[model samples]
Target chain A: SQTIHQWPATLVQPVGSPLSLECTVEGTSNPNLYWYRQAAGRGLQLLFYSVGIGQISSEVPQNLSASRPQDRQFILSSKKLLLSDSGFYLCAWSVWEHFGDTEAFFGQGTRLTVV
Target chain B: SQQGEEDPQALSIQEGENATMNCSYKTSINNLQWYRQNSGRGLVHLILIRSNEREKHSGRLRVTLDTSKKSSSLLITASRAADTASYFCATEGNAGGTSYGKLTFGQGTILTVHP
Candidate 1:
């Protein structure tokens, strides 16, 4: 069975403060990892995705960045957070296959509120 | 820019009723998937229908896809109060490009089932 773990289910940070959210998955190898953010009443926006270690592709240019330093470990970070950076962050993984039709598994989200 | 859109931004229903949500996308997709998310939580993959398949079912979930219309629908039969959540539709591209493995999501339909 595969499980994804995301830390600090809730966070409150001041504007301009550094931010880091960690996500890791177990029981899967070489899976495609993704980071997404959801607004209060809107759909999700893809932030970053990694096909493998050291390989990252960003979909939106925003205040946040993502890094996959090791397989199954993804980190979302921001050097200086802005008030608009607050949202629900999610981590997801899918099989690294070529068909592009596989389903994704998501982790518990992190709720960040910038105050 | 490839994001999909779900209609009836919010839906309220009673327990033991049926709920239906619709989603439309802009580009060609390899598959369309339905996901459920409780408030401020990670999304759970509910069901998926491929571009070649017209319909799919899992438990209480029924998904229908129309590639000609580039649209999909999710139906929850005999809904329970616990089924209240935001339902989102995501599409994966069949045409590979820089954004090959990423899943594009639509603004979700918020479903609330009351007991």
Candidate 2:
């Protein structure tokens, strides 16, 4: 069984402050990792994804960045936070397989508020 | 982008009643997946239906996919108050060649099952 964990369940940061959110998955190796943000009353917007260590792909360019330093550890960071950066951030992962559907599982998520 | 759109953006139903939500996407897909998210939390995968399959069931969830119509529906039988959450449909992209884990999700349907 694989479980995803995220830290700082709720955060309140001042504008222009730095931000760092961590995510890690246990019981899975080299699983695909993803970062998503959900705006109020909107859909989940993909920000970044990683296939393996040192491999990160950005889906949308914004005030956020993601890094995978280890196979099971992923981090989302920003040098300075913006007001628009406030949202529910989620980390997810799925097994790497070809052809057919591999479902992605999500973590508990972190809610960030920028003032 | 290549996202799906969920119909009946919001649904309210009483407990013990059935709730159905529909999602329509553009282009072809390898599979369609449904997920549920409680307020300010990560999404929980409910079910996945492959393109070749027309239906799937898990617990009280029933999912149906129609390739010709490029749409799918999720039915929750005997809904409970705990089932109140936002439901989203995600589709695996139809890019040629190898398939990456690029999932475009719908705006989502908010379901409120009152007791």
Candidate 3:
């Protein structure tokens, strides 16, 4: 059984503070990873996705960036956070190709509040 | 730019009634997927329909896709209070490669199932 983990579960930071959110997957190897953000009562916005280690594609232009340092480790970072960055962040992973039973699985998520 | 847009920004319904959500996309896609998100929680994958397919069912959920109309619909039969959540549609385009994992999301529909 594959499981995804993200942390810290919640964070409160002042404007311009640096931010780092981590996501790791267990029970799978070399899976595609994705980062998404959701505002209250809104739909998800795909921020970034990775096909392989060190390979990332960004969807939106923002102060945030993502990196996949290892096969199952992904990181979301912001050198300087802004008020608009406050939202619920999610991490997801999916198996490559072989779509038989492969579906994206999400982590518990991180609630970031930028004050 | 988002790929799909769900209609009826918000809906409130009594339990036991059926709930239907519609999604329209801007460009041609190879497949479409639906997801559900509880309040402040990560999204959960619901269903996926290929462009060649018209309808699919899982439990009390039924999904229909019409490539000719560039739209899709999700139906939750006999809804319950626990069905209250936001629903989003995602699109997988036909570019870059057949199995490319890039997915674009849309604004979601918020469904409130009152008990």
Summarize candidate 1's per-residue lDDT along A4-105 as a digit string, tens digits: 999889999999999999999999999899998888888888889999999988888889889999999999999999999999999999884646468899
Q: DockQ winner among the candidates?
A: 2
lDDT of each structure? 0.90, 0.90, 0.87
Q: In model 3, where do residues sit more than 4 Å from their true spots?
A: A99-102
Q: Please state the error at residue B27 of candidate 2 in Å.
A: 2.4
lDDT for model 1, on a 0 to 1 scale?
A: 0.90
DockQ of 3: 0.49
What are the per-model numbers of colliding residue pairs?
0, 0, 0
Q: Largest lDDT belongs to which candidate?
A: 2
Tell me the fnat of candidate 1. Answer: 0.59
lDDT of 2 by residue, B1-115 (tens): 5378998999999999999999999988888999999888889988988889999999999999999999999999999999999999999876776455667889999999999
Model 3: per-residue Cα lDDT over A1-115, one tens digit each? 8889999999999999999999999998999899989787666778999989999988889999999989999999999999999999999988756442345788989999999
Better of 2 and 3 by DockQ: 2
Q: Of the pair 2 and 3, which is ahead by TM-score?
A: 2
Residue B2 lDDT, candidate 3, scale 0-100: 73
